[model samples]
Target: MPGLSPRPEAAAFLRRWREALIGACVAVLGLYWVIFSFGLMIWIGWAVAAAGVVLGVAGIQRARFRAGSDGPGVVRVLEGRIAYMGPLDGGTADLETLRALRLDPTGLPAHWILDRPDQPPLAIPVTAQGADALFDAFASLPGMRTEHMLRSLNAPGGASVIVWRAADPAQKRLH
Candidate 1:
């Protein structure tokens, strides 16, 4: 009942995805109209536009369902452990409260890797403008310990990783 709410990050992702879908739909509609007026290849253009609209709607519906699902984000924390959700290939991971912080400077688009044994490392893409805020957030975690540096994956500029040890293991477990 509790672990089933939408997180702020997820909401933001949905918002951006919606905007992109709308833009794509508009473009597809314009193309459909142009092709219709030309009187050549009208059917093909209509099909393509229809497919685009269907796919866009499906994606939005999927995101909405995910946002409403009963999952890890629904829980409330008072004075126990704190867990942050991160995307995994198959499911999701509840990152440790705060263990260690590592910053790497090798990847081009730059990324922050948060390390924790309880969950897989969270690799967050970073921009120059967001680096300071990200660092501050990590530093502000309730109980963080060791930090480390890792190798980059051939990105252009550089990258960084941050590790934190969670204070409450119970609350940090992945749902």
Candidate 2:
């Protein structure tokens, strides 16, 4: 039973599994709707199926995310606002006003460099507490391709690369 025993330290990582299960269920149900919408209400079925796909994808992505304690500090996201209280740097950035986002993995822990007009860039460690929530928040950005962002995030480390920009140039420059 020694191998079956749980470690106290491992309990923290238990938070990661719940989101994935929910995502899987959503995806399965959505796929069912898509495949079974053969004769009736095809349009509505497809529409709902699409929404489910989005939710499922986002949920799975967030599930796979883990904000370990190795990072400098913690992050909090609430009501569309992103805040970071870190050691080397700390700041808050409004998610709705985000103009650009880049991932910098050159450091020990990766950071999501959030840029907004009239404010300094906020660098929040990707592994900070609540950073997993950013996945859903990020999906709301207009014109962002979900698959592309996910691929970039999983890409090998290198110089900071801008993964997303606001859909409207005016918003990018003004906000």
Candidate 3:
């Protein structure tokens, strides 16, 4: 049993890629079905393969959103809030109330700035513990452009970029 356990670095690597690897395996199985199945089954296989491809693409983006958990804070996404407990600073941002999201790349490890209407912004390092959960959190935002967020997160150091902004309160009231 001990021998079967992966080494620390290997475990870390796998942890970072586990979803993508699972997606790859699913896609392969679907492809195999497409190759050897009967007529109706062949149609089913195509559907399965299509679903697998979508899962695989999402997994790849999630993997890209993951930064190592070696940074200075621990992030917790609970209910509808994201809380960051850092060495020198800490705060919480309610998803329902988040007004804007920004990427500040001036620090050694970049930070995600979560803005809420009445509170100071919560600055969470991209590499903080449990930061990967942010992918789902950010995705839940209406009209969030995920690819742009991923690109900005991985870009070279520069000025802050606003990744998302909540719709105007007046517009929401009209709806």
- How many angstroms is residue 89 displaced in model 3 relative to the true structure, after the best TM-score fit? 2.1
Select the stronger candidate by TM-score from 1 and 3: 3
What value of lDDT does candidate 2 attain over all alpha carbons?
0.73
Which segments of model 1 are wrong by more than 4 Å?
1-96, 128-133, 142-175
Candidate 2 residue-wise lDDT, 60-105, digit = tens: 6765555465667777778888778887779888877898988787
Least lDDT summed over 10 consecutive residues: which range in candidate 2? Answer: 12-21
Q: Write the per-residue lDDT of candidate 3 for residues 56-143, one digit (tens) a residue.
A: 8888899899989999999999997898999999988889899999999998799999888877888999999999999999999988
**Highest TM-score scorer:** 3
Task: Provide the TM-score for each candidate, comma-separated.
Answer: 0.28, 0.68, 0.89
**TM-score, candidate number 2:** 0.68
Cα lDDT tens digits, model 1, 1-175, are 9789899887767664773477477558857676656665666567666677777765543333222232222221223332333233222233334455554446433445556567676544443222322433543466643132112222234434344445555767576
Sorted on lDDT, best first, the list reads 3, 2, 1
In each prediction, how many residue pairs overlap at the backbone (N, C-alpha, C within less than 3 A)? 29, 1, 0
**TM-score order of candidates, best first?**
3, 2, 1
